[model samples]
Target chain A: MIDIFTKFSGQLFVGLGWTILSSVIALFFSLIIGTVFAIMEVVPSKIARFIGRAYVEILRNIPLLVITMFFYLVIPKYVMKINGFTAGTIGLTLYTSAFIAETIRSGIQSVSGGQMEGARSTGMTYWQAMRYIILPQAFKIVIPPLGNQFVNLVKNSSVLAFVAGFDLMYQANSIASTTFDQINSYLVVGVLYLIITLPLSYYMQYLEKKLA
Target chain B: MSMIEFHDVQKYYGHFHALHDINLEIDEGETVVLIGPSGSGKSTLVRTVNGLETIQKGQLIVNGHDLSDPKTNLNILRSDVGMVFQHFNLYKNKDVLENIMLAPRIVSHIPEEENKKRAMELLEMVGLEKWAHNMPSQISGGQKQRVAIARTLAMRPKLILYDEPTSALDPEMIDDVLQVIKKVTNESGMTSLIVTHEMGFAKEVANRVIFMDQGQIVEDENSASFFEQPKTVRAQQFLSKIISH
Candidate 1:
C-alpha cells in the first residue's frame, strides 16, 4: 500500500492540474454567461425575460451529470466530435451559470425600487442607471452568495471523471482499479479534494468579510 | 408659459382612480403647496409632473413635453423637473456628497471638478458641508432629507417637487428640513410644488395652497385665503384636523 502510494503521488499531482484547469475554464465562462443571462432576466423586453427564465429553469433542474453526459456522449456521436474535457467544462459552465443567474437576479431585486426611481427621475436612461447605480449595488449584495456558487463550481468539476475527462477523480479511479488498494486510493483522493476545497472555502469567507 | 400643466389628467391604479380629472397649472417661480389627508392623491399629482406616475388620460405637460404622448421623451422632461421624496430616498451606499454629485456627473455628463464644486455649494446651502463624506446611513432623518434637497438643486432644475418632505422626519427634525426648503424656495425663484402636512410651513413658504380629497382638488386659493377661510367643507375639515394635532 505504501509503495503504491509513493508510485502514484506524481499521478495525483497531474490530476490536480486537470482539476485546476477544468475549474478555471468553467469559472471564466460561467461568469460571462451568467452575467448575460442576469441582464436578460432584468431587461424590460418580454422576449428577453422569457428566454432568460427558460434557460435558467432548464439548466438548473437537470442533474449536472446528465448535462455532462449529454455533451460528452450524445453530442460527439452526432453533432460534433468534442472530447470529454471540453464536454465536462461546457456542462459545468452551463449548470453553474443557471445558479449564478438566479443569485444575481435576486441580488438585483433586493436593491430598493426607490434607487431605480431616483436614478430614472434624474434623467438617466434605463441601461445607464442599471450600469452605474443599480448593478454596482446589486453586485455588492450578491457577493457572498456568488462566492458559494464559485466554490460549488470548483467541486462539481469532479463530474469530469464520469466522462473520462482525465480530471482528479478519473485518475483516482484508475489508480484504485489497477492497484487494488481501494480504501487508501480513495482516502488519498479525498485528501486531494480537501486540499482544493478547503482553501477555496477559506478564500470565499475571506472575500465575504473583506467586501462586507 | 406655465412650468407645468395637467389638463383633465386622470390616473387609475387598476380601477381605483388615483387622480380624478385633475386640471391645474403651475407658473414658473410660483411656490404651490398641496395639502390633503392621506390617500388624497397629492403625492401622485406631483409625481406625474416628473413622469414618475403616468397619467392615463388627458394631457400632462411639463416644460412643454406632453407626458400623455408615448413619443414624448420623459428623460428630457425629468431632467428639468426634480423631485425630493418624503422618505428622502438617499442612495444608502453613497456618501452625502456622492449622492448630490451622482446625477449631475452621470446624467448631465458634468465634469468631475465642476460637479464637485456645484455639489459642495448645494451642501453648503443646506448646511451639511461638514457631512459630505458621511454615508446616508450615518445621517439623521432631517439631514438626509436636506441632502436629498441639495441633490435635487444640484441639477439646477426649472422646477422642484417636494412630496411630503417632512412627513417622515421626527418632530424635532421637521423644522430644520422645512427651514432649508423655505430658504431655497425663497432665495432661488425656482418653481416649487410641495405636498405637505405641515400647515405652518405651507402658510409661511407657499404663495398658493391647493386642497385635495378623494383624488379631487377641493379648492385652489392663495395661501392667506385658503387658511384664513377655507371655502370647501373637506378643506376646512382637513385643516381643522391637521391644526388640532
Candidate 2:
C-alpha cells in the first residue's frame, strides 16, 4: 500500500478528486429530487402519490449498476452521446434519491401526532401546519438518516469506476493491473474513500446535536 | 343566540359508536362542564363543535356555521373556536411567546406589533410573563397548559373547549392550570365547554354540568341543582363515586 501510494500519488489524487466531485454533484441533486418526490407521496392528491410511489419503487428495486450501464451504453448509442462521468452521476443521483425520498417521507409522517392538531385547532389551514410546524420538526428527525444516505452516496460513487469515470476505484483498477499489486492498490483507494466518508458521517452527527 | 348546537348528532369510529344522538345547546357566555366515565364520549362531543371530529348523522352548528354541510369553510368557522388538549400540544420548535403569537399573526392577519403586544398580555394573564422566551419543553406541565390556554385566547375565539386540560398534569400542578382556566372563563365570558375529572373545579367554574354515560347524556342540569340533588340514578352514583374518592 505504501509503495502504491508513493509511486502513483499523482494518479491516485486525481482519481480521489474525481470521486469527490461526482459524490458532491450526486448528493446535491438527489436531495432535491428526493424532497420533491417525498412531498408528492404525501400530498392529498392521489395521482401525485401514485407517481411518487412508482418512481421510488422502480428506481430503488433495480440494480444500480444496470441503471448506470443503460445510461452509459444506450444514451451514447442511440441518443446524443454523453461522457461516462455524467451518466454515472445521473445514475447515482436517481438511485440514491429513491431511498432518500423514503427516509424523508417517513420522517414527515412521524412528526409528533399532537403538533398538527395543535396548529389546526388554532384555525390554521392544513398547509399552514405542514409548513410551519410539521416540516421543521420532520427535517430535524431526518437529519440522522439523511446523514447515512449522504455517506452511502459517497461510497456508491464507486459506481463511477465501472463506467470509466476515472474515480478512485477506477484508478486503483488501472494501477493494480499495471503493477500486479492488486491488494496494495485497492487498499490505498479504500483508505481514501474512508477519509471522505468519515468526515461526512461526523458532520451529520454534529448537525443532529446542534439541532437537538 | 346559541354559540354551539348539536341536533341529533351521531359519531362513529368504524362501527364503534363514539357519540349517540347528541342534542345540546350552548348559549353565548355560558360556561358548561362535561363529566363522564373514561369512554363516555365527553371528549368526542366537545371535539365535534370545532369540526375536529366529524359526525356521521345530524347537524352541528358552531358560531353560526353549519358543520354538517360540506360546503361550510371549517377554517373560517374554527377562527372563532379554540381548543386546549390534555397533552398541552404546544409547538415544540417555537418559544412560548411565538406559540401564542403564531395563529393571530398568520390566520387572523393581525399586525405584527399588535400581535406581539397581545401575546405578551396573554402570557401575563396566564402568569407566565417571565417564561415567554422559554421553549415548551423547558416549562412545567402546568405552565405548558397555561401557555396553551393563552395561545388559544390569542385568536380571540368566541368559544373555547377544554378537553381535560389538566388530565396530564401532576397533582400539585393541576390547581395552577384549573385556576388559569377559571380566570379565563370568568373574565372573558367566552362560551366554554370543559371535560374534567375535577368535580370541585367544575362546580365552581361551570354554570351548567353535563353528565354522560355510554355515549349518551344522562343528565344535563344547572351546576348548583345537579350538585344539590342529581335526578338520575347514574348521575347520583357517579357524583358519589367521585366524592368518595
Candidate 3:
C-alpha cells in the first residue's frame, strides 16, 4: 500500500481534482434543474405538472450509466462533438436532478397548506408565496434527504471511469493495470472516497441539528 | 357603500353544494360574527372574500372589485384584506418580526425602516413585542396567533377575517388571542368578519351576528337582540347546544 501511494501520488491527486471538479459542476446544475422541475410538478397548471412528472419519472428510472453512455457515444456521433467529461457530467446532472426533484417535491408537499393560504391572504401572489414562504420551509424539511442525494451523486461520479473521464476510479484502474497491485490501488481509491463522503455526512447532520 | 356584497352567490364542491343563494352585505367598520355548526359554510363564505375559495354563480364584489368578473385581479383585493387562521400559520422559517414584516415589504414594498417600525408597533399592540426574535415553533399557541395577527395587520388591510382563530388553542390560551384581536379591531376600526364558537367574545365584540345552518344564513340581527332572542329555530338550537357546553 505504501509503495503504491509513493509511486502513484501525483496521478492519484490529479484524479482526485477531476473528481471534485465534476462533482461540483454536477451538484450546482442539478440543484437548479431539480428545483425548477419540483416547482413545475406542484404548480397549478396541469401541463407544467405533467412535464415535470414525466421528466422526473423517465430520467430517474433509467440507469445512470446508460444515460452517461448515450451522451458520450451517441451525441458526438449524431449532432455535436463533446468530450467524455462533459458528457458524463451532463448525464450525472440530469440523472441526479430527477431524484432531487422528487426529494424537493415531497418536501414542498410536506409543508402545511395553510402556509400558502396565509401568505396569499396577505396579498402575495402565488409565485411570491411559493418563493418566500413555501420553498424555504420545504428546503429546510428536505436538508437531510438532500444531503443523502448529494453523497450519492458524488459516489456516482465514478461512472466517469467507463467513459475515460479520468476520475478517481479511472486512476485506480490505470494504477492497477501498471503496478499489478489491484487490491492496494482500489483500496486507496476507496479511502479517498470515504474522505469525501464522511465529512459530507457529518456536515449534513450538523446542518439538520442547527436548523432544528 | 358596502365593503362587501354577495348577490345570489352559490358555490359547489362538485356534487356537494357548499354555499347556496347567499345574499349578504358587510358595511365598512362593522364587526360581524358568523356562527354555525361545523360544515355550515361560514368558513367557505369568508374564504371567498380573499379568493381562497371561489364562488361559482353570482356577483361578488369586494373593496370595489367585481369578483364575479373573470378578469378581476384578486391579488390587489387581498392586499386590503387580512386573514387570521385557526392554525395561526406563522411562517415557520421566519422569526416573529420577519413574519410580520414580510408581506408589507414584499407585497406592498414598505420602506424597510418604516416597515420595521410599524411591525414593532403592531407587535407591541398584540403584546408580543418581546417575542420579536422567537421562531413560531418556540412560541406558545396564543403567542403564535398574536404574531399571526401582527403579520396580517402589517399590511394595513381595510378588512380582516378571523376564521376560528382561537379554536385551535388551549382553553387557557384562548383569552390572550381573543384579547389581542379585540384590541386590534377596536383601535384600527377595521371591518371584521369573524367565525367563532366563542359566544361570549362574539357578543362582546360584534355589532351584528349572522347565524348559518346547512350552507344558508338563517338569521342576521343585532348582536344584543340575537344573543337575547335568537329568531330562527336552528339558531336557538345551535346557541343552546354551544352555550350548554
Runs in model 3 deviating more than 4 A are none
Model 3 residue B194 CA deviation (Å) reads: 0.7
TM accuracy, model 1: 0.96
How would the candidate models be sorted by lDDT, starting from the highest? 3, 2, 1
Off by over 4 Å in 1: A1-5, A77-79
lDDT for model 3, please.
0.94
How displaced is residue B227 in candidate 3, in Å? 1.8
Model 3 per-residue lDDT tens digits across residues B86-196 = 998999989999999999999999999999999999899888899899889899999999899999989999999999999999999999999988998788899999999
Clashing pairs in 3: none
DockQ of candidate 2 relative to the true structure:
0.77
Question: TM-score of candidate 3's chain B against its reference?
Answer: 0.99
- Report fnat for all candidates as fractions from 0 to 1: 0.58, 0.73, 0.90
Q: What are the iRMS values of all candidates? A: 1.1, 0.6, 0.6
**How displaced is residue B188 in candidate 1, in Å?**
1.2
| Candidate 2 per-residue C-alpha lDDT over B139-159 given as tens digits, one digit per residue, 9 for 90 to 100 | 999999999999999999999
List, residue by residue over A43-132, the lDDT tens digit for candidate 1: 989999999999999999999999999999999998989999999999999999999999989988899988988878778888878887
Give the candidate order by descending DockQ.
3, 2, 1
